[model samples]
Every structure is written in C-alpha cells, then in structure tokens.
Target: MLDQALKNQLAAYLQRVTQPFELVASLDDSQTSREMQELLETIAGLSAHITLRTDGQDARRPSFALQRPGSDHQLRFAGLPLGHEFTSLVLALLWTGGHPPKVEPELIEQIQALDGDFAFEVYMSLSCHNCPDVVQALSLMAILNPKVKTTVIEGGAFKAEVEAREVMAVPMVFLNGEVFGSGRMLLEEIVAKLDTGSAAREAAKLDEKAPYDMLVVGGGPAGAAAAVYAARKGIRTGVAAERMGGQTNDTMAIENYISVLETDGPKFAAAIEAQVRHYGVDVMNLQQATALIPAESEGGLVQVKLANGATLKARSVVLSTGARWRNVNVPGEQEYKNKGVAYCPHCDGPLFKGKRVAVIGGGNSGVEAAIDLAGIVAHVTLIEFADQLKADAVLVAKLKSLPNVTIHVNAQTTEITGADGKVNGIKFKDRVSGDEHLVPLEGVFVQIGLVPNTEWLKGTVELSRFGEIVVDAKGHTNVPGVFAAGDCTTVPYKQIVIAAGEGAKAALSAFDHLIRLPAAA
Candidate 1:
C-alpha cells in the first residue's frame, strides 16, 4: 500500500526493531476486516522482526491488539489504523518492539502515580496530522502502566460511535467516558485531569463569588493575549473558556502571524496557553459561559454564569469566544465526517495529497481552499451553490489559472458518497440546468461561513445581525466596562494576529477602566 519512497522511510524507522512484537488482528468475513488486514500486513512486511496474526472472528468488524516482551496492557483498536491514526499504530508497534518511551522522569512519575483505573478513549480522524501526538501519549501510558488502558477509535470508521459521542472534531479525549479535553492537548494536561479524581472534585472547589479585576472569556489567541496583558498590569485576571485553544486549534498550517514564519493550530494554541499560564493568569477551562449578568453600576461586580451551575464574578469581562465552520449538513455529511468529509482545509488538506478532492462553497474560503489544495493534491473540483462564484476577482482568476482545478457554479452538494467506512465521491445537483451528477473524489472541504460563538451573549451586549458582539477600536462593547475581541466580535478580518492585537487593546482598555474606578468601600 505504501510507495517506494514511503517504504524506504519505514525501513529506516524499523532498523532498530530488535525486540519482536506481534500484531493480533481480530478478523471476520467483512470488507472492513479485509482492508484492515491489508494495512497491517503491509506494516508487518516491512520488518522481519515483526509478526502478524489473525485470530478471532469479529463478525463484520475488525480490531487490533499489540503484544510483546515488556508491555502487557490491553491496548486495542476497534477501528482500522489509517488516516491520522496510522501514526499511532506505527508508534504503538515501535514502542512494543523495544523503543523505550521517550519521556521525562517527572512525566513518567506522574503517570505511575495515577491511582485509579482510567480508560483513555481517543476519537481521531485518519487525516489529522496532530492527532498522533495525543493518541501516542495515552497509548504510551498504557504501555508503561498496567492500571491505564487506551482504546483508539477511528472517528471516521465508527460513525455511530462518533454520533453518540456528539463529536464534531478529532483528538477528543474521554477520560472515564467524560469529555476531559479536546483538540491538541499536552501530557501535563492529561496528568492534571488524572490528578483530579472527578469533575465533581474539580467543580466543588470553585468560589463563584470571588471577584476578579478582569475576567477574559474564551481561550483562543485573543483571550490568552488579553489575560497576559491584564496579568502584567498586576491585577487579578481570570480566563474562562470552553476550550483553551479556540478555533485556532483547527488550523493545520499558519504563516500569516507576524514574527512567526510558520506554525500549526495545535502548536499555536499550546503557545498561547503556555504564555497565559506563565503570567499567572487563572484559567478555568471546559466551562461554558451561559449568560452575562451585568453589573448594576460602575465598579460593581458582574456575574458570569457557567453551564455547570456556577456563577463567577468580575469587575470587567472580555468576550473572545471564537467562531466555527458552518456545516453543509447534507446526508452522509455527519455519517462520513472525518472519514472523508472535512471542514478545515488547512488541517485535513495535506492528508489528501496526490488524491482528488471536492470543495463545497465558492466564497473566499472555498476559493482559498481550492488554491491551497491544488498545490498539494493531484486534482481539485470546486462546487458552488450560488449562480456565480462569490470570491474576489483576483482569487477567481488565480483559481482559473490552476490547471488542476475545476469549478461548477449554481450547484448544490446533495450528499457525500462512499462505502465500507470511507468516502469515495460526492452527489450534487445543478440549479440552472436541473441536473444531478456525481464526482469521484476522496475528500470534501466545507467552507460555507463562520458562525460566531455568541448565542449566549444575545440581548446582553449589542450584537450585529449575525450575532457577533459589537466592539469599537479599543475592543469596548456597548455595555460599560465590557469588552469583546476575536472572531466573536465585529473585527473585520478574523486572523490570529488581528485577534491578538484586539485582545491586547481590550486588556489595556480594561486596565484603564480599573484605574478610573471609584474608591473601594
């Protein structure tokens, strides 16, 4: 299944495999099982020191479990190891084949000290490049400790499981069946969650009435920047966000941010978090802001209610909740999501290199995705629902200049088509011609629009027609002492540097608000 170049790379990687490892694949009379067998056989064929076995009948399903000299933990895969998960499979096999876990003693001690039996269920897409780090981390723990077990479920393979979990994205870690963290997470974060016995224990220690000089909501680059700026002013600042990374974590490649030539979403998000924590900013994660209770007067404490029945108070608040990609919601879209249907082209585009893919929507994002993928993939087909392409003339001309790109306007994406756990094509209908057609493509990128994360802020602060918070040049919202920034606000272009600058302005504005406060009672 691998090309000559890829096989050569694999050979070099497996040269140090001195210990023998066995890949036990549970097979059945199913096509998925057949595909899984082919993938495993290809890997096992690369090294003479490795062995493969097909033992149990799993009906139409297939699973993999690794066994070797040192590891006895039951780390299993209920889904095929492909896409972003292929790396996890390789890393798992390599570790069992005697590649000692490359980790710090402190991290090893933390994993060893984890007391309870924890099951780390990681949902991943085969196409996500960043997912391997998270998956390998948890699996490494299972390999080292007997108390911990890891289950790798390919999010695209198990559509029903993904739906039951209400998962919309990859690298979603469920520690004990509860959503512990999402996006690109760090090892210390896993250990930190394990340190807390239960969510109840974590929530029970919070003081809802404790006031802060500034509370920065949202954990994206904007919110993190605001917290850092506020903290530097020597005021009590707390950052409450649904997830610490925001939408920035969904991006795969970023080169536009100033002073940084290149970076990925996960790395940038981690950098933002590290900076915020380094400044002693109190960060409350996994807490959704449900409503805003405005302060009665100047210098009065404002209450920020959380989804978990907790009300946090702050003298001022900065809203930086980011936006999410608008899904097409067509049939097979939810079912085939991450299997072949994707949202972020920057994140999942590289996975489709040298393969044909489809882009739904023809706005700037769609045109940009087509342009980006054209350079990597072998062919590109762009489908637009509107009568004419809505992208800028320059972008449209650039797209036209690409020989590999094919654009179809006034066409609607009807369904994403595939079988046996993968996407193979798409079904669409023409608005003008009233004709239906199918395009053979391996992946789909939906770039319709961005819906701001401001539903909870309705009627609280002044909002635009699209529900985005109204903010001035200084990030000040309509309400007194309340500020907003990032994609959730009226910022013209939603970019990392733009949001970060807006956040800094909001933080400075908030500090100025604090300085002019009335005398303390």
Candidate 2:
C-alpha cells in the first residue's frame, strides 16, 4: 500500500516510539481487508515496539485499532488512512507510542480531564484537506484519555454507511451516534465544546489583556501577513479569527501561488500561520468578532467586541475578515445543505461517486468543479447564469471535451429540489425563453463566487454597494484608525498572493497611522 520512499519515512518516524503498541485489525476475505493486512504488516515491520494482531473482533471489517498495552485509550481507522488522512494515522501512532504531541500543555490536560466517554466517529473523504485536523484532534484526545475513543470512517470505503446516515459532506463528525459537527474544527474548539466552562475562562482572560498596538480581525492569508508585519515592528500585536485558516482551509489545488510550484490550501495556510506565530503574534483562533466600536477619542484604543462577550482594545485595527462562498439562497437550498447541496466539490465529490451531479455557475470555480467531478461522478451538468462561460479558454475547452459533462448557459438556478430530506434535483430557467427546467441529480455544487464577510461592518464602516469594505490604495478605510484588506475590502482580484500583499500594505498603513497619534493621557 505504501511506496519504498514512504516506507522509509514511516520507519524514520517510528523510531520515536518509546512505548510498545499494537495494530489489531479485523479482516475479511475482501480486497480492502487484504490490503489492510498488508499495510499493517508493513507498518509493524518498521518499528521494534510495534505488534500486529489480525484477530480483532471489531464488527467493521478492514478496520484497525491503535492501542497501547494495558491501556484502554485507543484510536481506530475503519478504512485506509491515506491521502490527507495519512498524517492523522502517523500522528496517532506516534502519540499512542508515548511520543509527545505539539499541542499546548493546558489543552493536553483538558483532554485528560474530560469526564464522560466520547466515542467520536468522523466520516471523511481521502481528498478532503480539512479532515486530518479533526481526525488528529480526536485521536489526540483518545490517546491522552481512556474515556475518549475515535473512529475515522472513510466515506469512499463504506458508501452504504454514508448514504444511510445521509452524509453529503466530508469531515462530518458524530459524537456517540449523533451528529456533532459538519466541517473543519480546531483542537481547541473541540475541547471548548466538551468543556463548557472553557469559553467563560477564555473570555475572562481576553478581557484582562492589555490593549494591543495592532489587532487583526481575521486569520486568513491577509490576516496572517498583517499580524506578522505588525509584530515585526516591535509593537504588541494580536489576531482574533473565527478560524485560523479561514476560506483558505476549504480550497483544494493551489497552483497559482507564486514561488511555490503547487500546493493545497491547508498546507499554504499552515505555512503562513507558522510564520505569524514565529514573530510572537498573539493569535486567538475560533474567536468571532461581532461588533467594532471605534475609540471615543482620537488616538485612543478601538474596542472590538467578540461573540464571547469579551472586547479587545487596539490602537490600530486591521479588518481582514475575508469572504465566504456565495450561496444560491434559492428554495430548499438551506434545508438540503449537506443533505446533497454542497459548496466544496473537492470535499464532497467522493460521496456522489457514479451518481449524477450539477454544478452551478460557469466561472473558473464552477468550470473547474465540473471538470473535477466528471471523473468521480457519473455525469456533470454545468449551469451558468451568464450568456457564456466566464472561465479561461483552456478550462472551457477542457470542460467541453469531457463526454459526461453538459453545459447550460443563460440559466438561472431557481431552487434545489429534494425529497426524503435529501437533494434529488435542481430547478433552473433559461433566460431567453423563460422556460424552467429541472435537472435530476443526486448533488448540487454551488461555485458562483464569494461575498465579503463585511455584514457586521455594515453600519460601522463605509462599504461599497457590493458590501466590500471601502479602502484607499494604502488600505486605509473610512475610519481613521481602522484599515481593511483582502477579499473583504475593495481589492479587484481576490487571490491569495494579492491578499497577502494587501495585508502587508494594510499593516504598514496602520503602523504609519499609529506613529502620528497624539500622546495618550
């Protein structure tokens, strides 16, 4: 299952194992079970402290459990943990074998102190970039505390179970048989959910913090750049974001990023976040900012209110809240989200394998999604509201050449039709004839565009008609001590490289504004 180079790397990593562990696998006469056996054998051969047992009585065939001798703490994988989940498997092995994890000491203690039993089942796709974080987080909890157990189920490997649960998305987490969450989640966020009082404690801590010189309100590429640039100026800096990676975490292939030949969104986001942390920036992830209160006096601290009821004060604020995927907002769309209506093709495509699916929009994202889904799905129906496809000529040509793909231009998506609590078709109308048609499919992929996450700043700052934060060339907003950058601002192109550059510009502009402030009383 693993190549020679990968085997060598696995062997090297296994050398850190200070305790003995076992890979107990339940197998059957299926091909997947055979492959699982080979994989377990290969892994056991890599380390002296590892043992393989094929007599596991797990009901799920082709499944394995990583367990320490005489310890109830365990982590299980019901399918091959390759692709993005490969890292999760490696980390589980290391952590189970007494190798130290990189998480904070406080978080480790919290995991160990959890009270109730947590049987976490994460349904994930191999192509999903966001699943590893959740899988690894739960695995860490399981390895740290005997009360926690995690089972990562590969969606592609067990299609019947996925369909039975009506799971239409990757990284769909279930706690004790009920749905817990449906997307990427941070380790801290998971613990915060389990430990209810953690939020109150964190809010109190944040309220006691001193005012920062520069405070960034997002954790995307733009926010990371802004935080790093500000911290490098020898001034106090802080970053508050709902999620550290933001929309970048949802992105798939990123070949357009300069310097780097090719990479994925999660990798790029992790790299930038590491760089920001390297500069000693105080990053508070999973903190949602609900309101912006400008300083009462000139050169005073700007108070940013968080959803947790804590307010952070900063002399200069960089608003890089970024953008989210634009929803179709048609009828049944909301009711069927993750019930067959999904925005991410890379993450949800595997769930609809050999099934018909529709892609809404004709731009690069829609066209690219169609092309990628054509291989996994039985058929791809591309719907565009414009008269013609807005994608590049090369991409359009490639899409047209696909045999299983169909294109519909000048079509408006009216509603996503579904029954039995799952999507079944999509309704659209042709602009020329005003004729409405319904395309029968099992899934709908919305790739229209992005809408700025400036809804909270509607009354606080000057925004464009399209709801983007109005910013000058220097990234300064209408507010005196406030600035905006990236997709949330008036930037023409919403590219990662452009966002990073704009973030730097906004940081520099904030610094310039700070130096001219009058002496505080």
Candidate 3:
C-alpha cells in the first residue's frame, strides 16, 4: 500500500483542482490477497476519481454521477491497459487537453461554461471499436470540464449491472442517470452538449419494475402504427416516446399517399395517435427509451427501460423508432433548421406551393418530391451535389419531364438565408463554375437522406451501414424474442402505410414467440 503521506498529498491535489468532486470505487471482487487489498484501499484513498466504499453501490447511480475536474477524470483499470485499446487512452489524454481537434467551437464554449455536475456511462462490447472513440471523446469532456465525469464499462464484465439497467446494445451512453444521444459524437459536439439542458430529466423518471406484455420504443408514425396493432393483438402494450409524431410531424402535405387526396402533416400524426389510443394502449408522452434487453433462458422475459425510472417487463419488444433527417455536416446547417430549413416536401412544400423552393440531393426521394412539388409550386429547383443524378433512370426521366423543375447538375447548398419566422431564399455554389448565387425562395426541402436511429445497436443486432435494423420479413432481429419494424428497420420503403403494415407483422412474430415459450419451458 502507498504511504499515508502520499495519500494525503493526492487528496489535497484533488480538492484544490475543483469543487463537488466525489469518489466512487468500482470494485469487481472482494476476495483478494492482503497486499492487493491494501494496495486497492491505498489507491482508493488517493484516487481523485472514485470514493472508497465498504457497502456495495447500486449500479444505476454511476450513470448520474457528477464530476469535478481534477478530481473527476478517473481512468482506472484493474488490469494493465494494453492492446489496440491502448490507443484510446492516448486519445483520452488529448481530449482532456484544451482545444482538441475536430471539436466544434460552440461545443467547447458550452463545456467550458458548465457548472452543474454530469456523469456519462457508456456500455461497450469487446467487438465494438467504434465505442472506444465515443468513450475517448466523453473522457476528454470530463477532463476539460470540471463539472462532467465519464465512465466506460465493458458490457460482458458487467452482466448483472447491465441486466439491472436493461441495456440492449453496445456503445450506449447514459447522461445524468438518463440516456444522452448514442452512436458517434464529435469533440465539438460533446462540448456543445454541455450547454443544452438534460432531455432525460425533463421526461419521465425510470420505474425499473413496470409490467407489460410488450413495449414499443417509438411514437412516430411507425411506432404509433405498431402500438395500434399490438393493442389489437390483446397484448398489454406500452409506448414510450420523446415526441409522438417523429418525422411525420414535419411533413408539409402528403399528396401521393394512397386514399388521402391531400392531407397536412400534423393532422395525419394526430389521426394515427388517436387510433392507437382507442385501443387503450399505454402511451407515455415526453419519455425516451434508452435500452432494450432480450429475454434470458429459464423464465426470463424481455425488458424495456426508459430514461425515466419507468421500466416494463414484456413477453415481446417492438422497435419502430423510425428515422431522423440527415444533416449536411456543413457550416450554418444547424442554425437554419426550421427557418428556411425543411426535411419533407410533402410537409413544407405547400407553404411555398405558388412560390419557389430548392430541393437538394439527386436521389429517388429527392426526384420524386421535386416532381410532385413542381405540380403545385411555382418554381422547383433541384440541386444535385453529385456530378450526375444517381436516381433510377425512370425517375430521372420523369423529373426531366417537368418543365417547372429546373435540374442543376453538380450544385450544392452552402447556406440558407431567411427573414423573420420563415425561409426566404438559399445560397448555392455551382460545382462546375465555382459561382455562388442566392436563389430567392419560400421553401427549401432537404432530401439528402434519412439516418436510422440504430447506432447504439451495433454488435447487439444486425445493422446495415445506413444504420437500419436488419430483420426478417416477420420483423425478427438476428437474436430471438426481439423484433423491429418501420423506417428504423431494414425495410425497402419508408411510407407510413408500410410502417403500419410492418408493425402488424412484428406484433404477430412476437406473439408467436411468446406462445411457444410456455411449451418450450
């Protein structure tokens, strides 16, 4: 064990660095040699990172643990840190340094200004190298900001801990006892996050022990569609969501939708939600689910938990979280969201029906939306950042058929200019001529692409590079008892009707598994 003088010096160093620094000893085994025990205790006493404890700690607390700089950036490992993972440690050091590269300037400002304590817990599997980057990024934030502390836990070594938390995937991040965003994060983004208020806290608290036959994790058109179907199946289904409508809430006016002559977006979302409620499905509003755990052998049941303390044990699980719009990753894109900004033409195009609107990207979705909007809007500008339109030949031909739609080859949107509460025009640069021009317009529809919300699911389930969940037509994950459907899953189309149909398929598949479980047991 280290000498008492060294422990006192370490403690003084930690206290001088920051305030409200707390310690949490992460002990895996109690049985050890006396020398080892003494060493651990001595280390614990000297640790500015963790507090030594005699009583065991509850697993849930780590996710919310607050950190104060000098005392908070704990990088302790029981064994020698080596192998490819050693690279992560070096990166972590770089993160702790001020002004890490690739970090957004705004994010740095937010992190530097943080005063409240926050903890970040990330679950990682052995196979996930992507997770290490996130861990490193978060660790950097902890070191830079005295108020933030981060922890990286190996999923396999923490089985009981993970089970208690109901973690369904690797590389999952929980902030302040609730889930923050998952997948990849830029250093600048992490710094920026320090300024934003916690979404999990404003939502419901986790229950840890709720009961339901099935739990659906989304509230979008796909998730709502799934919930209605699951309720009809006579299962006690619960739906948890941050917002009820998902991307469907942002549509302008869906014209091509079958059976609907011309309908607005908000109305469509409301109608779907109404239908789900008619069946008495438990819909938890302002709630976000963080993880999903499969049912274990020997009477174990699937468990769904949320950022709030609320949890539900289920015979089946349906993931219909749907997709989020993709950003250009360019400058000024974020500041323009909902200003001159838009994702769905059917949702926002009619607002500019008689005016001008510029559509970015040259995919089938972009071409289709442009073609449709050309009929109702005055001037339709289609901008393809690529050299050629990569859409199907038939779609390209159809778009060319529209006289009102002007297709600009090799054009990219650089910035959006607006006045007051609405969009007025956009700035674009010609890829060929290097000429930049501002096109006056009332709307701008970004059809670049959709990103599925499955980044946290790597190694936990099969996912395409596009981040869509891979499932059989029946909506089953590669693993048993877990099912997925809608836009978030690997389906060909991303239509509301298709999602509704897929929701039904997933429910039936889950029901089949539950029915057979009794016989098998």
TM-score of every candidate relative to the true structure:
0.70, 0.99, 0.52
Cα-based lDDT for every prediction: 0.82, 0.93, 0.66
Native-to-model Cα distance after best TM-score fit, residue 359 in candidate 1, in Å: 1.3
lDDT per residue as tens, model 1, 1-521: 56788778777888767788788888876778888888778879889988899984433257887777465575778778765566677778777677867676867887887887888888777767567768888888887778898888776567767767656456778878888776566565677667765345545555533789999989998899999999999999999888888887777678999999998777788789889999998888877889999999989988888876677899999999989888898988888886778777755665566789999989988999999999988999999998899999999999999999999998989999988767889989998888999998888888898989999988899999988999888989988889989989988988889889999999999989889999898
Q: What pairs collide in candidate 2? A: none
Residue-wise C-alpha lDDT for candidate 3, range 23-123, written one tens digit per residue:
23333443322333454455445535444443325443222122334454544322211222344543443333222445547556666678877778776
How many pairs of residues collide in each model? 3, 0, 22
Per-residue C-alpha lDDT of model 2 across residues 239-358, encoded as one tens digit per residue: 999988778888888898889999999998888888999999999988999999998888988999999999999999999999999999999889999899999898899999999999
Model 1 segments more than 4 A misplaced = 1-127, 140-145, 151-197, 329-332, 346-356, 371-379, 387-398, 401-404, 414-443
lDDT for position 360 in model 1: 92
